[model samples]
Target: DVKVTQSSRYLVKRTGEKVFLECVQDMDHENMFWYRQDPGLGLRLIYFSYDVKMKEKGDIPEGYSVSREKKERFSLILESASTNQTSMYLCASSLYGFNQPQHFGDGTRLSIL
Candidate 1:
């Protein structure tokens, strides 16, 4: 089984503060994704990378950035966190191909005050 580990389970920060959440995958997956899940909005992809040093912005990338210096690690950064940005962030990994299921981490619940 593939194991995806998140650096933090929960985070609390004030508005305008810079924040970062990290995720690491045990298996060598070529595709990694960062998504933010909201109550009614559903899961929205924030960023993704298919290889090291390569990244692509997902649906909602404003005020957020990602880095994939290594294949196993992906970091999500909030340039200046806002109360509206507070949400459950999820990380997933999978092989770059069809019919592959992405293994997901527990998720990080962030709160901006």
Candidate 2:
């Protein structure tokens, strides 16, 4: 079965700290995505990579970055995190378009204090 695994289910951090959230897929998918979910705004795409060593910015990529050094793993980095950056981070993997459904990890709830 396909599975997406996240390194942490809960995280707490201080302001100005650097945060790293990791995700891995076991199905050898070609695409990986990072999204932040908030109360009323819904899921907002932060970043996504179509292939290893390649990535593209999504709706809100201003304070976030991503790395896909391996086919099965992806990492989301928050450079100099802040309180307002706290949210539920989700990682997903899927085959390219044609209405492919993405498999998602449980999510990392990061709280920047």
Best by TM-score: 2
lDDT of 1 at 85: 96
Backbone clash numbers for all candidates listed: 0, 0
Per-candidate Cα lDDT values, in order, are 0.96, 0.96
Instruction: Residues 8-35, candidate 1: write the lDDT tens digits.
Output: 9999999999999999999999999999
Error of 2 at 96 (Å): 1.7
Against the hidden reference, what TM-scores do the models get? 0.97, 0.98
Q: What range of 10 consecutive residues in model 1 has the weakest lDDT sum? A: 94-103
In candidate 1, stretches whose alpha carbon ends up further than 4 angstroms from where it belongs are none
TM-score of 1: 0.97
